[model samples]
Target: MTASMTSPDTARIAAITLTFLLAGTVKGVTGMGLPTVAMGVLGTLMLPAEAAALLILPSLVTNVWQLLAGPRLGALVRRFWLMMTGIVIGTVAAASFIAGSGGVWATTGLGAALTLYAASGLLSWHFTVPPRHERRLSPVIGVVTGLVTGATGVFVVPAVPYLQALDLKKEDLVQALGLSFTVSTVALAIGLARASAFTTTDLTSSLLAVVPALLGMWAGQRIRGHISPATFRRWFFFCMLALGLQLLLRHLI
Candidate 1:
């Protein structure tokens, strides 16, 4: 509804576009920041559920590609069934309970989650979940990850670390993240629908947002060819930390 340039809504539309562009670029280079970046910024401007709704289509599209592009898609599914089950169930349940409520708790939850994510990145913490204990720990991790996703529209944090801990090959790790995100996206959509947080307009906006995200990904890939990854990641984490702090402060105050 706010798409016109000179219709008194130019600034808002511009902000949304810029946010999506930046979110896309982050994901393009970092391979996992679209939803996190988008939600972090958008949550400041709108309800958390609305922000989550806007990311649905873009996140689904990117992660679907990420999932399909990897080796052993079927094999991976078979291997991670328990974890996947927990994620789906937890996301659905949590979202059903927390959806459409963007009060202090939601803001603080998102902020805390962001801080935790950034801290891990800042510290370069690599928690390793050994193969022997993978099955035992995965379901628990999946449930927690799903709860976080349901609450904040972010599916990384613990899930990414859990996947990283597996110590899979680099490519495999990326694919695993994709798989997990794709599933989370689907469950999130379902939960939003149940909570009346999703609407036709939101779906349309989300679909349109996919364009900027993909374009940014292309640009980011080109830029990544020129920049130092270490520098980029450090900046990314710091930025996330700052935004997290702001959110927390706003909520606490």
Candidate 2:
């Protein structure tokens, strides 16, 4: 009875680990996409709430690592403080309604986010936010991004596009992304906890998935120079686009 009952769980855990491994590798090579890819892939296997619960630990740890590894943490924080605050507010406000729904709405929203993200990548779109505009727009962008994160557990969309438009030095941009993602992850975690979605088994599974995430990152770094990031990104976005469309169609149909 024990083995029989445990079998499905064991397989599910294995699948979770592999999903993070792949997601982490993408983050390693491209410097982002961990949550987007993980949520996208896992959406196929489980409810968005369940997937969000499993995502907490690995996403938090990895984003923290990324946050600290950068050179301009202090300045990034000072500059983006308002935006982060907006993220907290927006996420907290929307969490109950969006994540708690965890049904057709959440699934459809996730699909929409993935499709938007993938479309941006595939188009190689470039946007520029001027310094004067940054102050005015950061908070708005944060709130919108948080709403999306709360709904879909993916925090890309306008936040990334806005950040990219900032015209920071490459390293600073990377660090900024880390800071934004870390804040978003923490907020999302809090929202999940408040929603009572993090069961003990799910928490353990989340913690265990961190190992595979790290391992995948290491492997991706080793192979980074050998593989063309551009080519890989094209393929990755294509896959995400297809998966996103599938999710939307599955529930709608």
Candidate 3:
């Protein structure tokens, strides 16, 4: 690999670190959102493929922490089995596809999709597909999520809104995110391995960067308790919309 491609410059490293710190803080405070925030910001600096690879380890670690910290892990697991299954299948398919053909197209598409979703959330415009006889929307969501996860390394968008629509309890939402990430990360790692994207250097860099991720998560957790849920949701959706639009514009141009 060429120096420019393999060895990210100091500015890039600095940007990644700062972004992760912010992501960690948001996730810690809200119980989830690190990848969405980080991916959107980092896409401006690095290739989408690189950003996805960089986030793998940090996302894995943070989700692990979230999963273990919860009190009713087993119950949450049971409640969201259908959702989890969809995420797993969808993520694996997406990851495999991207591993073979990673580029701006995937990133741009992901950004556009996220922007639309975030805008809907911010505007309080909900899209509901009625469950007709023999409907299978849950697995479809899972498959789409997996595909997106494979392509962009961001799987939360597909599942999050659907879960929210269900009006699941707060803890249930958190647990579902945790479970989805864990499964998606595992699929991502395998896909990366097959693609030969995980260099020794990449692994080292990811390890070194873990500190910032942890710090951000801790910071987020501390502030999360103070904010009302409605306010948090509003800010989060706004941020997602802004980031998604920024990425889409950058890639399109």
Which one is best on TM-score?
A: 2
Screening candidate 2 with a backbone cut-off below 3 angstroms (N, C-alpha, C), the clashing residue pairs are none
User: On residues 188-236, what C-alpha lDDT tens digit does candidate 2 reach at each position?
Assistant: 8888778777667778878998999888777777778999989999999
Residue-pair clashes per candidate: 0, 0, 14
In angstroms, how far off is 86's CA in candidate 1?
1.1
TM-score of each: 0.94, 0.96, 0.85
Winning candidate number (lDDT) = 2
Against the true structure, candidate 1 reaches a TM-score of 0.94
Task: Estimate, for each residue in 57-101, the C-alpha lDDT of model 3 and write its tens digit.
Answer: 888899988787767888877666676777776666566555557
On TM-score, who's better, 1 or 3? 1
lDDT by candidate, in order shown: 0.85, 0.87, 0.75
Arranged by TM-score, best first: 2, 1, 3
Decide which is better by TM-score, 2 or 3: 2
Question: In model 2, which regions exceed 4 Å deviation?
Answer: none
Cα lDDT of model 1 by residue, 1-253, tens digit: 5447476566667777888889889888888888889988987887778888899998999889889989878978887878888888888887854465546678778888888999999999987777899989889988988888888888896889889888999888888889999999998998888888888988998888888888887788788879998899999999989888887788577
